[model samples]
Target chain A: MKTKGSILTHKPSRRQVLAYGGATMLSTPFISRAWAAPVEINMLAWYGHGEPDIVSEFEAANNVKFKPKYYAGGDNMLGLIAQSPPGTYDVILSDGEFVQQLNAAGYIEELNAADYPFDDMLYGDFQKFPGHWKDGKLYSMMVRFGHLGVSYNKNAISAEEAMSYSCFWKPEVKGKVGHFDWHLPSLGMMSLYDGNGAGLWDLSGSQWKKVQATTLSLRPQVGGYFDYGGTFNSLKNGEMQAMCGIGDWITGVLEKDGAPVGSVVPKEGGIQWTESYCIGKGSEKAEIVKKFIQYMLSPAGQVKSAKMAAYPGFAITKSGRAKLIEVDRKEAKRTGQIDGMANDPITLVKEGRIHYRNIPVQQSLEDWNDFWSEYKNA
Target chain B: MPVSGKRTQSALVETTPKRLLSHLLTFKNAVRLPIIIWQALFFIAPLMFMVAMSFFIVRNYRMTEAFEMKNWLKMMGRDYFWDSYGLTIGLATLATLVVMTVAFPAAYTLAFKVSENTRRWAVFLLIIPFFTSYLVRIFSWYVILAESGVINAMLGYIGLGPYIMLNTKFGTIVGYMTLTLPLVIILQTLSLANIDRSLVEAAHNLGCRPWRTVFRIVLPLARTGLIIAAVFCFILSFGDFVSPYYLGGSKPPTLPILIVDTVKSGQQWPRAAVVAVVMMVTLFIVAFGGIAAAYRRRVR
Candidate 1:
């Protein structure tokens, strides 16, 4: 019993055990914290929605990390969700137009309406955003939106001239008009220009042809078609006198940087691009994600959206708009966030000068895309 | 006992070559297996998947497995696809010609006119551009090529007008040159520097002009490398999306851009695959043709 191996197997006395237990208990919090892994929440969103600028504060407060998978188009967003496992994403920040598709595919969870602040919404449309709810149940929550209209170089095109979509064809700006290369918004603008009004996307066959004809006619004026970066650079540098299919979402950044660029909801009306948050269908972190969406809809979150560094959108809630005005009155004023301002986006919507950017009602998206490709080739 | 021993010896004698052959094959396979596995896993498998995906259909933005030519028929039926095809071929061919022509003199200087140290330094400097992102390099050109940018400002100083350059076919070519020129120069220099000095000396001793010596002696010997370099440039330019979209403004839309548009529109990856397959076929034909022409010897 007293052999060399017996020394290795010796048990601790009661006093020794108590002392050891006390030391271990004293260090437990530090040891556990040192080893504790932060929870990971996967977010599928547009480029800036999940970036540190928007999510870092929330991350630090919640002991969670966001892993963002960003996409450029609604179709792209849908494609990504389809390819992934059911619970791969904990949250999805989708373009409002694609929320319907996401819901139709059953990729998102049915959210409780009571969790979000629908009563605080600045616009009535935000209370029941089209396609965000099904059969009296909420699915996605609208957070921010921007209008797509004629974005222009203020130095070249007078504000009055830029008011109408016909200014895109001005003889002076010939070979200087640029398109923001997505087919939907650009063709939608063309539809509005052709006086399709609220039925911009729900075109009759003849109206669709007319929209195509109008876009083709502008081909000679188009210097180039550009993505976001190109559109920004061209306008900032005065290479493009006018741009179609974009608005303050782009030019607002440039204007802040002393670029003589501005975007206006033209006389032909404009299209609204909204972005919203939804919990993924099978996310185990649905409660936390729901909290995050509520946070995004909060005054602080709305302020963040309004002042998002990547590209700004209007604050959707009344309290959020008030917070933006209080904190950054200059920005709020510049973007026409004040209630009675001439370019107030809410007023534009109220006046029926803004239509939600939607997929085509009569024609398939591919048909519009096909015609777009044809237009570019023309 | 002697007859039985002879039969056993005869059987062993017959089996010896076959055993050696098996051992030899095992050794050879050991040497070749890694590369075979690599090509099969990375290249053949993906290519097969791509071919299969092209036949599959997309429903609700999700790809479902099927064997059909619907995507092919749809893509091929579109006029824009053909237009994009012509534009892509034309632009790539133009870029290849321009790169080859522009790179030759610089390569010649580096090969023959410069000291060895200078040539080494030049090659090193040429390679430095690759350390930075190609998209960054393309963006930098905006500061130099924009309407109010450096070149235009300089043009304005001499009373010439500002010209539109940044988003034109000309701009696309410039971007392509930025991408391919350095590699082309290094290639041409290597090919030219490896020429037999004695042959060039002999041509010169016969009172051949310097330019004539280059044409008569230098070019033929470097033909293989030079042709290969041009082929590389063509391939790079043909598949490029950034240059055409960012610099060329995607006015007529190249095949690569068209592929992107096709995918972005309705998540029609099958249709995009159709475009991709066409591109791959064209590239394969061009590469094979180029190689055949490159190594072909002139019969005396």
Candidate 2:
């Protein structure tokens, strides 16, 4: 027992045993650190939000991974959330108009208003965006926004022609017009064209029918209905001379690629599509998700969103805009994000040329949808 | 007869039915049981569920369990539904006819004109396209068919056409042919290749014209396979959403697009279910009717 070989082969003295136990204790943490699994957060959102360009920095910093499920439209987003079980999604990105519906269905968690930088928003209305709060409690946080108007092939439709909704019915572009294959924005544009103005979504019964008639009148000139990708390709290739229901959010990407395309808000006005984020109701990872939301609102996150490869929208925060201007000034100027620019997004909002996109006010969503299907068939 | 002999005869009669029942459960049936179970579990059960779902109702965009005719009635009453249905049927029928006609000559060449080794190589080449996604193939057609594309550029040399083909029915037809032409040719080739050469020789020796021999001898022998191929074309074309939407531009929405629109609008899944059920019924009728017509004996 006193010899070294005998001590290793047989039971050791108390001093040797204590030394071995202390060594094992010191190495345990290093071994565990080498093999610990990163926490996974399930995200449901529109495309591009969860991509490496946006989330890699945050993931590396926080020791977590993201699994994203992407959807195309607000209704599609709602359908996916409805079909899934509670807690399946740890984080959800939603169109502002559907946040109320999400809250009503008990799908999203109530967020603390103080945790976000509402005071740092580019516009005051974003502080209390419609449908983001109920009973004075915040349910979601506004992240980014875009305007929807007439998107056109610059070669086919001149800037002047694209400035008014009436150009969609131009005789030269007949059977060359296309829709973005969503009912809300397209029908909302039709309402504005019908001269509803501020009351675009709040149409009465006769007004709703009149809006339907207006959309039908444009059907003959309509070449086809296309989803997001189809709309992009059709416009990029000149198959569609003018597209309704989309704006610079789409054309901006093509312009960056040197495609002769642009989006302009018609004199009638444009619809504003706001995107926001919320924590799922039953998510056990709420603490991490809350931190993620705060991170997305940071200036670095805002820069990533502005330069998103999928589609682009305006950064919502003041610091975010400053950061975008600092890092990518050409892009900032291209999208008119600079202060005092004629097409500046904030200036457009101040001029009352943009209306928040919303659900139907006077009729059920189904009614509008039915008319849309009818218009498509026509 | 003795009492013991009478008793044995009665016992044999009583056990005859049991022996016949045991004999019915052969190895062939044992092999078939798994497939039958699979169909019941995967196909029949889902079909029954879909039928049930069509009767349910949606409130606030949530589908709830209830048996009602409202979804069916609402969909059937809409004029657009009928319009889409008519358009879908017409397009699918047209695609079937065009594919069958175009594939016939190529199939005939492959079956009779080409060497067996060459025919096998051609079949392998036809199968190669299937390895790529159909959507990708449709997208590739864009570069070749666009107004400023390859075809149009070549036509410009002759001052021929800047044809509007990409967003029209013509484009849809092209996409359909791209999808079904090769498959139809392979099927028709296999069918025609299997026919007895003696029958064709006899017809030719009896002074039958070449075309006449084909119509009388070749067509009848290959009728089953040809009809099945046509049925497959019709079914695929009827159900395809990509060709009509991407190539045809969904200028006038088809039934499949209508189904999508129905579901997208306020999550009216019940209404979409209504559309799906109607499509299923139509397909079942077409498939069964086609099979019956294909196998029917010709009148003397």
Candidate 3:
């Protein structure tokens, strides 16, 4: 144009037009980046009574957004993780066996100890990687752990009768016993009843064969095998004479409902499972993730989580254990088992009664699948 | 030849190709081409992938690259798989029969007997249950059937004592019926409404008894709707995860529930996929066959 504005208003030559288009294309991404915002962290957790509140607190405390996905069971969460792209979740909460599998698959990143400010606050035993973690690089930190035991209808069975695994296998309870549908814990109890004890893990050849035989023997007597919530309902309604069940459901929901149910830590110790928090290997916000983990391990998080009937993963934090004992005392007093609440992890492990430690993947799968198939068919 | 006639012939030949090209590039047809391509790409491709994956082995939780017959072989051999399949098919069939029996009369009453104003409210009532969460509806059945629940509580008042129905196959079947009954009645009602009243009058005028008139005329005409309703009930009952899961005791896990457990345990993806694929194929065959049969009868 005669002036600069007039010149710009004129129709551009082909070369000039091409140059302007190239400039716009080159600058568009930069302009978009300038407006880009913080990435939202998505989380998936099991359906726990207190988990929703915990997630909300985490979101508010960090000034970060969280979208929580709930699942009916831990396996559902693991299945989701198995299918999703790595780092699709910034954080995941999983049970002990699943955490081990994730670590082995390299789907989880090793947490740098330095990033967690509250590591020293944890107890020595809790800090020791529970076989899933190795060396100094932690793969997962225990968020909660609980015992698996049997719950029986007190009106149907005596407290002393319910204290042993043999009670579930008794011929009298045929078509009346309820077992956890899961293999490891159910078969683990069977192995204990087979006189294997913690040595079940060390069994091979004919010794393992004996344990398998023991499971088959009990199969006929077993009325049903149930998952977590369903087991409690069955026990409460007296549909099952006795059930191999989790302590949480027995102590928390059933007892709270005033159901005449009693639980036991079998002479052969029951299985203990821990739920843990771990960062995915490909998470972009590793620092923030570590901060989140540290916060969960803090005393406040431990106590809040404990009140919901889950044992805090950190052994040094006595809050959860203390709360559990108090609740247990109340339950025992009501049920007239004054000393029943005395059973704890340390005592169980010290008594050489624990069945298996750090169950290997291959053996757990083989044993669980074989036992489940037999149990279902029987 | 005259110059003008020769020129006109050359011009006509030149324009023919261009006119054909313009016709081929019509806006409407061009737009429709992408939609057809997209349907094939997005809709048809995933189904093909699932069908192909069903034939392959999955190792280490990943579907293997090579084709294998292990999944199919394992499915055929496993008693657990067959038992669940048999249970699913039997339960589905029984539920379908029950639904048809109940829905026909209810639908007829709504279609012919009810006032138009009441008919709307009746249809509204039939569809209202669907607005609630499916899980909530199924769980409500537990309250009705539980040992200490409503049914047993009522029985107890009459000195019959509490009865256990909450964790049995019967309980699951009843729950499945409740979940499917509404859909069956609503669909059959729509079908009944479309029937020409003249046909029923003609059958009656021809000296047909009331029951005979209904059985011979109304039912035959409503065959398409009945088939559709059966298919809906069967599929819903067969694939039901919640009803069987919540209500069926551990003694007999449904096919969907079993697939869930297998996948969750993380030891048997290949097996789970096989179960899923079998369910899908069974559903597909039943649905298509039923539709085809209905179509044939309709055309005749």
How high is the CA lDDT of each candidate model? 0.92, 0.91, 0.70
For candidate 2, list the clashing residue pairs, or say none. Answer: none
TM-scores, each model vs. reference: 0.92, 0.93, 0.79
Candidate 3 lDDT, B174-283, residue by residue in tens: 87887999889988998988899999999888999999988888888888888888899998998988777777764677788778777766536666777888898899
The runs of at least 3 residues in candidate 3 whose Cα sits more than 4 Å from the true structure, single-residue gaps closed, are A1-45, A49-61, A69-79, A112-129, A135-137, A169-181, A201-227, A235-241, A309-341, A356-367, A370-374, B1-43, B56-59, B267-270, B297-300
Top candidate by TM-score: 2
Candidate 1 segments exceeding 4 Å error:
A1-35, B1-29
DockQ of each: 0.74, 0.73, 0.24
Q: DockQ score for model 3, please?
A: 0.24
Residues B85-145 of candidate 1: C-alpha lDDT, one tens digit per residue: 9999999999999999999999999998999999999999999999999999999999999
Error of 3 at A30 (Å): 31
Question: How well does candidate 3 score on lDDT at residue A360?
Answer: 38
Candidate 1 residue pairs in clash (backbone atoms < 3 Å): none
Name the docking class for model 1.
Answer: medium
lDDT score of residue B175 within candidate 2: 87
The best-first sequence of candidates by TM-score reads 2, 1, 3
Clashes of 2: 0
Task: State interface RMSD in Å for all models.
Answer: 0.9, 1.0, 2.9
- The model with the greatest DockQ is 1
